[model samples]
Target: MKFKSNILILVLLAVFIVCSVQSVSAANSHNFTTDDNFDTKFADVVNGDTFTFKAGSYNLTSDYLINKKVNLVAENEVIINSGDYRFNFASESNGSSVKGFVFLGDSNNPKATTPIATTGPTEDITINNNTFKYVYDGVSFGRYATNNFEFTNNIIDGFLRDALNLGGGSGHGDVYIVNNIIKNNLSAKDGIAIAYKGSGNLTINNNTISNVIEAISINSFNAPDLNATVIIKNNIFDNVETVIEDPNHSEIIDSYNVFNNSGESSLTHTPKEPANIIINSTISKSSISKDGSVNYTVKITNSGNRTADNITLTITLPNSLKYVKTISKTTGDYKNNEWTITALDAGSSATLSLTLNAKSTGKQTIKSSSSYLNGNETTPKEGQTTTILSVNKLSTKITVVVAKSAILGSTSKFKITVKDKNGKVLANKNIKVKVNSKIYTGKTNSNGIATVNAKISNKGKYNVKISFAGTSDYSASSKSVQHKVTASDLKIAGVKRIGKNYIVKVKNIGDISSKSTKVAISFKTDNKPGVIQYATVKVKALKPGKTVSVLVKFYINKIYSSHKRNVIIEESKTFKEASYENNIISIRK
Candidate 1:
């Protein structure tokens, strides 16, 4: 009976120990869904806890702080739409991992949005198989320190500035970045920007980077160890402006990298007291007329820690502007559109001025690029700023000179002139004049005057229109002048007969001259109204209120002693007359 009882107790103890082990395992792992509150779940979790997020979308409005070691896993198709929020891993959050999750950020505030960041010293943080889009920064190595980080199999498609930023802090152990895709970013200046201060081994292998300005930019660290090394191998770089830009580090190893449409790799020795060049340009007039000129000023500065020697700057003038000459320069000489600076110390600046004539009229652009040397290191960095200039066309005025009143059947003369806004006459300009339903075209002479003539038939008020079609340097203009025209009248004034000679007088009774016409005289005998003899006289142009006399002789067929004769004078129809009653006269002889 005692042996059987001991066997039972041993069996029960074994079962109890097995149950305790299972319970601990269950407590360490937790499952969450999109409907659950992450804050509540995180508060009840302990170190080394595994939180598995179910397949759904999780919205986070604020930053989620992780102060203990944790492992976050995504079940399948997990999306975290964090609007301007990030996951903050604190100092104690070492040995933490974030895996297989998609993070979305508000692209509107990309400069201020970060997907994942570190607050203090963190180590052994693994961020793998994650997708980040529309974020300012993908991952941040803390400013204090970071070590033994693994960032692999991640797709960082879009970011405002940097995809991976090693925040100029001390880093230790090994950093493995493998088999990742970083592409389709226009606002990022550097793909993996590193400014590491500590000693470590960085490996970048089998990664694909494209469409970035600089695939990898390694700036000079503040105080880095001398024995640090960076190994870059077997990476595919395509369509990147620059493959790698590292000017201050010599401990980097690069091999077996395939480049297509990616610019050549640059590696230069570290320079002592490197120089930084800054260029700024401005125009005296943003908008000017085609006949005007503008002044351009370029101020160059050396804002680096040391002085720069033999700095060269080039200015590219657009087709809308022509370089006239150099006005003033504080230092350096300009030729062939290039400006040379012999030396520029740190924190010093120089000014250059030049006059540019507005050649064509439109929006003009001026571009400037520069290159400099520092301590036997010739690294050319291109910097540009577009300064817009607008050249406007000058306005013009048309002046017309004409008479207020003109005589009928006479030519009306018009004088048209064109001038600019500055009262400068524009020569050889085409002009159009419209008068009395006729259009006459002419060009202005050297004196800017054009003469046009039109015939006036009726007597009334009329408008004489003159227009100047502007040239490339001037604008169009038009003017109108009012004119009046009057008609003429002619009449026979008196008639006289002396011996066998007859004298006839014709007068113009209107305000203008009359055309050449004829006058006739007839003689009748006794009481009969039959004409016995006739004579005619010709008269030339008669002026206003003027009279002229002409003589005509006729021979009589038969002479009678007791005969009463009637003599008559009449005017011909060569021009219009006001009345016909005053054009004829009768007398007995």
Candidate 2:
């Protein structure tokens, strides 16, 4: 009986222990669905409790503090409209999260309080996918050493101050901000999209920010001991005055960012230094001829504040312009298109002159920049000057020849001659001939003649202008000539046998004159084992619609009964004619 009673007790104790463990596990979760105030309920929940909020709008008059290591999650779209209230996270709020909630601020209260503020040193706090709209400040973590804090995938809009201010004190470590859309903040002075004043490393990646005064501002209150490493990668900035405004003593690693503003710099930073050197550059002449050279004056002045040591001046010359020599009071070295000034003392000016020869023509821009060695504090000075160079123009003349009258719809020969001022013909020159507003371009041959064949479709007086576009060694010139175009067609009418001599009649059937024509006549014996003969005659010029006859006497074989003769008016390949099919005729007797 005692053993059995002990067994029963052990079973009851095991059941009681299991029930106790289940109750303790069930007490870690608190779910609230009503529209009641969650301030008292949140306080009643134990540390490390999972507080889940249902889908509803909760109006709060005071701040909701997530003081312990708790997870405050929303089941649906939970909107928290605050009336002079905000959400605060305490120092013990490590490993806590407040995600998937819309934080609406009270615009009536114009004070600079963040919608989500961190009160004490909080670490490993993840606030993701939360929207803060019309809030004075988006997320403010007061000067505390917070580590491993992540604020990702959040939409922060309409914040008066900073959209995300991680500045409270120094020594914050490993804050990852990724994929957030922040825009339209009203605070011009301190309204930055992501401002980091802490000392540890920050990674801001894949965020789209626009319409803010400054996109990312990194200023650590002149704290020399505080050195923060900020890595901003793959973020887009549009319409922001400055993408990054980093002061001295902060190391920023920036890459793969798309900035839409063309006028401003994508990243702007000033190094903190005790001494600075200012450089100014000026050009002697703004315009120079291609044969002339320009003088560049670079002045390096120390503003009486600090002695700049090992000052180096780099001057980048324009393309196709050779650097001649440097003319300066102080000795400097010019090598590989850069001029280096060794050093400059405080409260002094170093003036240097560079002479550059313009090798080609066009506009050339010269850029001069200065940098200081031995850990200087001031920003580098830069200046630019543009020199417009006029191309060297050579005295030239163009002579064009077109026949007094050309055959319409027939190829006309145009010869263009280009010469220098001394009447010496220029070889291999580009010549453009404009005939009645039609342009024809060709390079002159070795004889300075550019010959072109053109057919005029209409009969009229046309103006032909020949132009020589000058080279670097020559000048451009043009000359004009006039020619009347008329129609002309040449054909062979017939071949007549007049008293044992064959006469081949060639006629020009249209207007204008045909020059340098050739007529060929062939005579063949109309018998077995035929004998063939040919004769070619040249006609100097034939007038329009005029006939000219040529006689050909052929001795046929006495054994043949009759003779067959063929006459053809040959056309010149160099000259274009109207028709060639009617230029042949046959005769048999």
Top candidate (TM-score): 1
What is the C-alpha local distance difference test score of candidate 2? 0.73
- When summed lDDT is taken over every stretch of 10 residues in candidate 1, the lowest stretch is 560-569
- Expressed as tens digits, the lDDT of each residue in 474-504 for candidate 2 is 7788887888777556787877777666777
In angstroms, how far off is 166's CA in candidate 2? 7.9
Worst 10 residues of 2 by lDDT: 266-275
Whole-model lDDT values for every prediction: 0.77, 0.73
lDDT of 1 by residue, 464-542 (tens): 7788877766778898889877666666677787886678777888777777776666665455545465566777888
Cα RMSD, each candidate: 19.5, 15.6
Q: TM-score for every candidate vs. truth?
A: 0.46, 0.42
Any idea what lDDT model 1 has?
0.77
